[model samples]
Target chain A: MHADSTTTRKAAALAAFAGLDREPGVAKPDPILVVDNVVRRFGGLTAVDVAHLEIQRGSITALIGPNGAGKTTFFNQLTGFDSADEGSWAFNGKQLKGVPAHRVARTGMVRTFQLTKALSKLTVMENMRLGAQNQRGENFFRALVPGSWRQQEDEITERAEELLERFKLNTKRDDFAGSLSGGQRKLLEMARALMVGPELVMLDEPMAGVNPALTQSLLAHVKDLREEGMTVLFVEHDMDMVRDISDWVVVMAQGAVIAEGPPDTIMSDQRVVDAYLGAHHDAPMSAEEFEEQLQEAEAELEAEIEEKA
Target chain B: MDWNAILITTVKASIGLETVVYALAAIGVNIQFGYAGLLNFGQAAFLGVAAYGMAVTVATFHLPFWLGIAIGLAATVVLAFLLGIPTLRLRADYLAIVTIAAAEIVRLVFRSVKFSSVFGGSDGRQNFSGDFFAMNPYSPGTYGIGPISFNERVTWILTVGWVLIAICCGLVYLLMKSPWGRVLKAIREDEDAVRSLGKNVFSYKMQALVLGGLVGCLGGFLFALGQASVQPDLFSTEFTFYAYTIVILGGAARVFSPVVGAAIFWVLLVFVGNTLSEAVSAGMLPSLFTVNNIGAVRFMLVGLGLMLLLIFRPQGIFGDKREIALDAR
Candidate 1:
């Protein structure tokens, strides 16, 4: 009976994510967020100029690109950290144009920074408590009267403790976030974002400075987020991590989306290769081979110079 | 040379009216700069507006003393709102620039001959504190031990001021331990992080401004009542800087740091000034150090002390250094 029930649950989970693993920008049966003609400009540079994009519900989507490809910039605009010059987008079918960053989080779409802002002066537990929504203790007058929010404060503490344990950070809960290692701070940030109970969590370069030892655990956490019925949109440069966990991938280059597909197809996409490897796509196999070829050319040029002298 | 007299006076100055006044002001600065990480260089304006509010209302407009006090607090709140609306959204330095300029404007307006009819211009106003002194419950006598004694009036003001300080400290302690205070600290460290967690950063900053301004305004009431007068020059930009010094000296972000800092600051000022004056009179020091020069010398010594403290221990006496290592960006 137990085995039958497990198989049934697995079948249901597979059905839910079936069509979402298709080509990116292809309309999902139930998309949690949709973007159209969103553009952002900084001085003379157009940082993000995404024409159209859609994030599938309950699927892990990777936004992969080379550096300066405007991946982070596009995330900022979508999450309301920065405003778009024009165009609009919707999350859960609600328009998000001109919404403030805090309001966007309140509307069940929260984002984590690429640099991992961990409220350095605050304790990890305090940072987690700050993430919980609508605490009575946040009210000025109520804050003075502890009894007014004591019960709710207890609830938030319990929740924060649970999240800390889940992220294996309960040991460091009392320590100041500034004292944490880079990877630990990234974990704290992710755990803090989860405290909001967000439907859509946007991660900006989750593995930027993380060690290889922690990368597997972080990847597992991202996949677990999808299993827990939350949609994730992440910006990453590691193609291995993208292929390992991402259901769909969106490739950006020079402030625009160049290609979108499942990770396997995206790896072979010519535009993505050109954007990443450039015109030297047919370069030598290894560093030693390339160095040998450079030496041969240099020897020929030196011989010509010697003969002229 | 009455060295004993100088020692007694220095001891008295440690807990005197000036100490209480600056301590109260520094507590407000603690909220703005220490906790919220706001750079408010116009804290003296809050005190100034309140003092003038009471002075104009009671002495010039013939209003009741209580009504004057109420109007004074309301005016401080209004000033906080007015200042916060335009500058809170900008960078921290913009608030500092605007606040210093706004404070100067307030002082100039109070000093201007155009407002002499209401503000009394540079000469200032008096007789507004009579009602407050009339309400003093203490008997008419000197109160205290030895040379530290105070008259009934001074005793009454000291009692009320210290009580207010205690209450304000308790309020701050309770608030800082709450979730709201957590958000303020987070904002101080990284506002973008707090905002990303669904906090209204602007609203929190504005609330902090109003709360700190209101607390600072209480210092103005005490000043006006203690002296029975209000002058435009008394609320100069130097007053705010003095408050900042006290906040840092006591340790920023700690509740009782300002109170202790204010006491130490006044004691040091009085001690240095008295010692230098006595030395000058006794011809123990060079003739260049006249009694009149003691004031400047005392301030210079305190300034030097502050610089050294910042270099060696930027967190002050009781503060954790991390609290003041703000990420204003």
Candidate 2:
């Protein structure tokens, strides 16, 4: 499927997302989501305090942070899963300040949870069908008249089957979602999200609980989303996976964006290191020890990622 | 010592008036608790309010039978709204608590002496069923085969009751298979998940509450019309509990489960009671168990059977085990 023309288009999209990665809180030429002054507080603790951020259209961005950096909280605020104490944002230039979570999804900004929220009691195919947009059968009155929605339901089933096949979950279509393995649930969640044909898909820790064997495939699927000309934003902890697939990296620490750059630059940036290690800015390590610690941190991160994978 | 009489009575009880009444109530519970995962412990309130609405409308206002039916239905819808608006958004247990309390309040209000003039107080209202029986087409004659029979009045009630049951079952079957039904099941599994998928979860829940409550009101109508009287004490919390037991016995989330369950429940209850009483009369047991104690003993057996069913198969007879793993939070 990697034809010559498609490779050029992928490269073109990659180039467009380049350079802007180096600037913190930078403006994008073609932004799909723009957030300003978004803050969420729980009691006295402020969980997220994003001042300004823009996600470029048709790019794969990674939101990476330590355990308590509030990446997921920020994701929740952006997607309307939770309300912000003070904020305003837009998706494709449509103001989404007070929009509900479902409406946010309707605007082509679909999201999946860190822990997969597959309807465990529902069959795999049913879970996929639930993801489809504007289903006629979902209407209360229209649902009773089969003639009004049967054809639409059939079409939805067909689309769901196609996605199941793509996700390699076709054989398990009749099985309850709860019966699937952890990795399969994650795959099913991603596949289900695509049933909306969304322009922007935000996944929270897609590979968190996946097996290593499936993590590679999950990574490939994330890359394929961008290849299909869709914008992908994911919150992840694994540096290797982020470096492997992310076009740009946005670092968060203490609930604020500390740096934005390409994977290589972000990995080497001093602030990113301090954010991860909690090291003081004035206490620079010796060259040899610094390199060793960096390698040690990467290895430790890899082991942790593998355990979850 | 007629074993023949006992067996016949048990068979008749399986398809008797009580079965029809409980079946109607359980089917409504199926929609709320089974399909939507709603904890509607006030199902009796729906039946009570509807029954009282019909009784008060006709006996107090001296209105026509048709008008009373309309008022009964309207009252059920209003009761659903009144109960749902304050509790639907809360956790599942809150709904359970609220509904049970609401049912008790309704029963107490109806039985209170303050409304004795209008509601007939503890005696409840009678004579309102005259119009219903008048509309009955059956002539004055006994119906059915030897050993099992019904008079014209009962025959008419059975005909109407069975027809209503069929219609309600058909409606549930159609709705559960539709996309709207899919959403209800999804809400049962995870309301947040459905909401995140762009569905108005709260609205769907309210609709299910109203629909189920409305369907349950049919049982109220059948209870009053078949007995030819409406009593406040008849619609107690135990009434709702019995309906729940019927729903669970039939295997929840299945359309025909409630019907089958109600039949089996009444049959078993009557069968056990008859057999025990006969055994006691025949001197087959000790003097500690008298015939009058048979009623309580029969319920104990049913309770035991239910516990066994839950332990061995928590999903009931026809239900998928996964369906009962409710995300009630």
Candidate 3:
């Protein structure tokens, strides 16, 4: 009933990392986040089990891995989307165990999803409203009587309009979110997330489906996120983009970290190459390749049947 | 009937039990569906629950009318939270499915054999309107000239109900224009984006759900007070269905959409039904059609009309399509 393979992958990764505990309770000074013995699991599938992971303060960190390397799973666990089977993490020294997704978000550890979840029916302006903030009017009792809540409402509208203008979505404010192109939706999603002014912005994949033209804009936005004193954590497949922006990189394969360092070091690590790059783990096999392999196996079976006959 | 008589009658009928009730429910739904993007198909349950809440408190517990009102509103909020907790995080359709089922279940519980003693069984509870009528400003007489006349008690209820509608609509307008309203609209548009901004998507949803449910519950209070009665069958799925029709008919996200929709919808229903019945009875039309069949036939015609409207203009009278989305997905 649930696609929780993510949970299992994280658990296995955490266990494996625990076994390689050459490092102690030690961490780099001024770490923004520390994941200690974080284990997440699905039924019979260990997805991410990170014994120790530290996010450097105010630096852009990229978590990279093959398709099933538990990168997204780990992201889920770290951000409170999924609870760790066994682990504890902290944001700005506040323990983030058993914290629900929203509570964690309230604490400034915000995250964007891989697939965009733009509310398609609302106008771009309405979408901005949704991203605005808590107001007295949000309460039904307070929804009435404008005098008590109008000033606050005005502030939210002003803020939303400012952000929409900055993101170049001002003209489209009256347009339905569904009418926006894919890249525009991406921009809207990013801009909407910034409405809260988060300290850490965890982007699942800021450029997975982005076109070349919008790629630079997204990259610049990510840089801006860094410049604004917000930590950026993204899962990206574009090695070139990764090297260009990521201050540090952590690579994972088969639900565990294979390497962690700068993008250049991670790209060259033989373990990472064998698990992802050289083996083409990042790209799922095409339908044609799968069919060809199936045909070859069927042919071999037929030959064996003939011999038996 | 004369043309003026027909027009007057149509307005009177349209503004009666159906529109008054539906307008209230749509206001509640505006909070949920319009602002929060919660596709709650069981809005009638809020009405049903509140009706029963009032009934149970006043009739069964023998409590005062205002106390009954408090209990009803409280019960509605609790019901919204209960329904929201399990389903809010699920896909939109899941909530729809669960809410429809829940609404039916609430209706059944209100009418069930075990609880029939308190609920008055299928016969429903009457004599509950006495307290409301005690405050009626009108003496026993028809107030309006021509076909626009209303009995004293009925006139009183309409006045109160319309005032409530005005207040609710104004509230929606002001809130939606405010910052909090913007956040709700944003959540509707992009929850993940809101989530990344450190807003609690689920909490916002819960808030919207409860608030809307409470507002929807008000309709039930009005209905019970209006009729001086509470019945299980009155809270049928059609009640919620008609509310959605009103919301869509007037405009989904617009503040006054429910009011316009309720008025237009009731007017259409009354006009169509009366015209058909009169035509049939007076032998001005085919003999095959009967007054009884008018109920079913009118629905089909209305449905067809609605479908055409949706195809051509999903946004009703005053709505900008961008203001509200018809896409449940």
Candidate 4:
């Protein structure tokens, strides 16, 4: 029964993109974030130069690329962490091009870092409390008068407790964030991001250093975010995660989008294969195959030397 | 050797005016550097500006004493803003550099002959604290136990200084427990992490700077009132360094640690200096340590003691061991 229900939900999640063409920068039925002519240059090298792209609302979109593909840079620009040389993008139909990172987050879109930035000195609970928005006691004058914000403070703590429980970090609530293991910190960061009550959540490599044992739980959490009706945009190199949780996939190479489609189709796309594996190679070279080829080349050189002698 | 006098002097110096001044300054440093992780090497500038503000208002302009107090606090806030606006948004090192330079600049400006009429140049200003003494409610008598006592004027100033320190400590305790202070602490750890969570990191830093500067200004007010004079040379870089030393020695991030740190620091200096001078005069030490050079040698011994403290217990007297481990991250 669970399997059948999950398939139905997955189908419903992908129904929005059913009629869209499998092409780079295809228009979505409902775009929550729209980008146009976003370009970033570093000296003589053009880092990110995406012409146009749209993120479908309430769908899990995976941004995948090889090393130095500018996937992280593009995420920075969209989330206001880094400024683009020239670009225009809108979140929820509001112009967010020049907005600062904190203001952008205030507008219901929050991001996590590529290198997880868990505030080490803060306790897990304090880190969670810092994530909450519109805190009354966060104001300097209001903080001095506890009577004014006592109720709000209690409510925020209650919410933080709920998130901590959900993320399975309740046991480590009072421990410093720095004390958490790599996997636990990832879960805490995701749970903390949810404390903002964001509509669109952006995660940069949520599973970068996480162990495989914890990868299953992390994947479930990502899926749960979509179930709760929040859009998720993530930059990742893990294709298994993208295929399992992502509803749609956008592939970038050389700082530009190369392909866009459902996960299965995008995996089979020839352009993606060319981008990952060079055009001349029909299939990816495995380590064993590479080793065999190296041995063969060395043997051939020895035979040539023997013939010459 | 007059051992009784030396012991009494040590006890007195522990809670003396110098202790109150450094304690207040260190409390301010605790807020900015300890809690917020701001590198404000120019904290002396905040105190300098406050002293000069009051001196210029009351002695030079003939304003009311209360107005001078208000102006002193206002000048501290303005100085915090001026330093914070350009550097708080940058990395932590920038504030350290700017603050150290700004403090020297403030001292130089006050020492300049061009503003001698207004700021009194090297002599600074005097007779500005007459109104402050006139308001004291203490009668003309010594007040204390045994040998450690104060006159009416000193008793009043000490009472005010201790009260101000209590209020500042209370304020720090309340703020650090709130979400506002949590944001500052988080910013101290990683500003980008706090920024990503929707906090205006720059504003919080600026507020921490201003709050700390105001606390530092209280120290300046007490110093000026206690001496009835403000000297430009007294508010030098070493004054700020002494405050930093006290903060680190007491324990960073704890509300009352600076107070404890200040008392210990003063007692050590006074005790060591007195002992050294007495030994030199009594012929208890070698001729290499004459009375004239004992002052300098006393400092060297104290420096060695501080170095030992840092090596053995870097977290200070009251700091959490867990915090020191987290700082390694």
Candidate 5:
């Protein structure tokens, strides 16, 4: 029963990309975000320079790369947090170039910070309520008259409460977010983003500082997002998480997309391997074999030294 | 020591004009610094600009008193926008730096000889408050209980000032409890976090600046009317620092804290200055401690008291310790 249920869960997302080739910038069957000629430069260094990329709708896409791969910078450009030097991207058929960060989020694409911004001074519940868009009470004039926004506030509180319960943070609802543990903060941040009712959720290194015991639950939360039909794009360095949760993987190296494929295939892709471990690293060898190779090189060096003498 | 005279003056100072003006100014600081985490070091500039706006319009252009009032408010809002547009997008400290400089510039411009004919240079404008006093509903008689009392003109301004303070406190309370206030507090903690959640952080900061500036401008209007004159030096950087001191003393971000804090601050200064001068006159202290230097001594003693209060309760009189803990960022 467990195996059958797991397969059914995977079937929904995997089936969509079954016929697509494992190639860089291959067209998705139903792309939600399409980027073209995106470039960002700081001084003389180009931080992110992607020619083309497409995010499939309703799939968990893992953007995997080593440090300084410009994954976060690309995320920043896509979400309107940072402007690209030259690029235009469309989200759900709307041109998002030059759009402000808040409007981009209002357009159903919400992002979380890598550092986990939990609004430390606010209670967990207030932090959640802050994520609800188009709040009537948020308007300055309407805010003064409690009658105008009381009902909407109640509804927002109700929704926030439900999300808190689902995230198992109902008990900490009234507690300041600053009091939460690192793992709980990540959960709260994810739960708060859902209050926006976003179509696309971008998480930047959600597991970076999280503890191991909470990793399983965090993984479950990511899967639940897919189950609810929301597209998720996450940046991660943990190979286990990338392989376990991601349906599609995009590898970035030196400010460019080097490989794209399903997680299983991308793990063995030659270029992906080279990007991670360098081109010189071949198949793994036994310890004795490695030692033997080192000694052989040392013996050849000794012979050269003797001939020179 | 003239105990009765000292007691009367000290008690009067607790509810004096200075207290009301600083209370209102500190309330504005509470909104900007206490809630929004905006470092508005130029709060005195808001007061200065409003006073000058009204003074220039009425004294120079011979406009109606009401028009001068309107112009003052309009100028304050414009000043807020001007100061906010460039600095709100930068770090919080930039606003502090710009506001401090802008405040000095406003004072100097009012004090400048180039516009002496318009701004009255060092003399400032007078006779512009005739309409304000004429509108007083109270009859010409002393009104008060015991030592805390005022004549009809003083009573009228006091009534108006206290009513303004009550209204501002009500407005702040209502706004702070709403979703808009929640966003401001969230911005205070982490603006980038609020922005990522779909809030227009810049717009919110600007609105906060304007709202706080308007409230602070009320103090400026009161100062002008009470003195029946607008002086540039009265709205100097020292005025802004006093307002900040009152806000911190009263426990920032709390409604009514500024009012209470301002009362306490003036009371301490008046009480200390009166006692020290009285003592010096009576030859109770040494010859070096003269009445002339008692004003400076009062501040020195009060500064020590403030240092002690901060050490024991850094969060101020009513601030939450948990909030202070979260201020590590």
Candidate 6:
């Protein structure tokens, strides 16, 4: 069909993101999210063109790619912020096309943004309240009756407070969210996502700008998400963090997945190396290099805390 | 100034006609912008819609006053939904724009020559408030504890208005403390994160919009019944702007913030206005301005106060800077 370089690139991306060599028999019994042929065009640029992708039920899958590789766009499309020009997906068995972002969230698939949109003016606890907002008591009639709204309000606050505590944000409950550091915000974002008790949680760059010392804890939290029986799909640039925590890895280059497999195999793949290291494929930080950085951060943090005491 | 004069001024300013109505409207704005963070700029439309609803039902259809109120509340919710459905997911500013436009549309609709019979056009409907006064328990005689007495009719309106304010504020306080309130705060902080938790962000936003609009509708009711009239000129964009000013002045997102804000807003404006006019008449200052400048000067002073508040305490009196720190856009 004499497709241009962009289409070829998209076609290539689609092939790679679709998990190139998957045989039909190997697929899971039921997929939580099944994204097929989801192509998104922004102006003249085709940002994402995935032929097929399946998020397994109750497992952590890290959607890893370089910047501008359409990871966030893909996440937005799935969650209803952005609509797909072509393609369809579903949460559990429900087809998700034309579903509004809010409705997508209602179906038990929630997400966090790359840029933290925490209500800066509200207390940290108030932010938690927003996460637990449901429709039952939000009705006009219910709002008119104090007795009707109290129990639900109490339960939501308690749960939100508990989640904040679990995330180590309990002490800052009264503090404004804007007062928190970048890392704390990331933590708050993650904690807030647990509000609606979603079956699927999508995190956009959960560890992108976090300090190394907290990276492990963040990674642990992502792993804990799976432990808690919620499927976690996260977009990450830190390969070591992805490799260390993710059960399955999906790698994208130029808006499509180029490789999908166990971390060890994906890391060793020739194409994956070329994508990260460029055609010359040399002089990139190794896994050992990453481990050393995290270790150093951990040591320094411990020393500081010890000194404070 | 005499103690009696100040007391009268304070009472007139606090429980004054415009004060009670705007207080109800400002509380609604708090629900929309302060609580839900919807950034609604067309709250006046809710007031306008409800007023027109009442005016049409009463003056046009000759229906009972309560039925008109129901239609008005319904119309506000419908207006909110119509505005929210198209623009809620768009940038928050889009909702602001659409609402402002819708409110203007509503005002024009009420004032349009084509619908003059039903809406009473520009001059609006009057003597329509007789039904509202029929429900008043107060006799048609003045009553008071002392110098703070009110005309029988004025007392009746204020009584109803204050009760509505208390109920709305109390309801807001309880509702805001609930699970739904938590979700709204979360949406304000991070809609994406809330959505990740399987929450319906859009639906919640719509609910907030409608709820806030429903509350705003009460302002229209109070205004219509307070003056015993409904005028197209009354529901101007400035009405909503003033409500926002009240919300910000008292505090955004706090239960008592709007009520306190409404009282302060009306008082400062009236007190300053009266003081300025008296000063100009007495020639206390050089004749740089005439009595006509009092209105402009009062507005300028109020605008200056809002500016100072935004600069020094953008969160208003009760708002936390952090809660307001979320990208307002």
Predicted candidate 4 versus true structure: per-residue lDDT over B1-329, tens digit per residue: 97998999999898889999999999999999999999999989999999899989999999999999999999999999999999998899999999999999999999999999999999999989999999999989999998899999999999999999999999999999888899999999899888888999999999999999999999999999999999999999999999999999999999999999999999999999999888888999998999789999998999999999998998999988888887676
| Interface RMSD, every prediction, one decimal place | 1.6, 1.6, 3.4, 0.7, 0.8, 3.6
Per-residue alpha-carbon lDDT of model 3 for A1-309, expressed as tens digits?
A: 122542343233233333232222334445789888877789999898787877766677788888988999899888888878998999999999998887787788877788987767767776666554455665656655668777875787789898888788899988878878888988988887777667888899989788999999888778767766677889998899999887777877777766676665667766778877576666799999999999999999999999999
Interface root-mean-square deviation of model 1 in angstroms is: 1.6
lDDT of every predicted structure (CA atoms): 0.89, 0.89, 0.79, 0.92, 0.92, 0.79
After superposition, which runs of candidate 1 have C-alpha atoms over 4 Å from their true positions? A1-24, A278-309, B321-329
lDDT of 5 by residue, B196-221 (tens): 88999999999999999999999999
Residue lDDT tens for model 1, A41-63? 89999988888888877778899
State the lDDT at A67 in candidate 2: 89
Q: What tens-digit string does per-residue lDDT give for candidate 6 at A1-309?
A: 423543443333234335434321134445688888889999999999888788777667788777788888988899888889999997888999888776787778878878876667667887776666464666656765668867876887899888987889999999878888888989988887787678898888888788888887787777667766788888888778777776667877787777777655677777777777686547678899889989999999999999999
Candidate 4 residue runs with Cα over 4 Å from true position: A1-5, A282-309
Model 2, range B85-195, lDDT digits (tens) per residue? 999887889999999999999999999999888888999999898899998898999888887888999999999999999999999998999999999998998887786
Query: On residues A1-309, what C-alpha lDDT tens digit does candidate 2 reach at each position?
Result: 566655765676678776664656888788899999999899999888989999988889999989899999998888887889998999999999888888888889989999888888889999999989899988888888989998998999999998888889999999889888899999998998899779999999998989999999999889889888899999999999999988888999989998898886788888888988777666778999889989999999999999999
Clashing pairs in 5: none
True-structure RMSD, every candidate:
6.4, 7.1, 8.3, 6.0, 5.0, 12.9
True contacts kept of each: 0.86, 0.68, 0.62, 0.89, 0.89, 0.58
Give the docking tier of candidate 6: acceptable
Clashes of 6: 26
User: Which candidate number maximizes DockQ?
Assistant: 5
lDDT of 1 by residue, B145-187 (tens): 9778999999999999999999999999999999889889888
Clashing pairs in 4: none
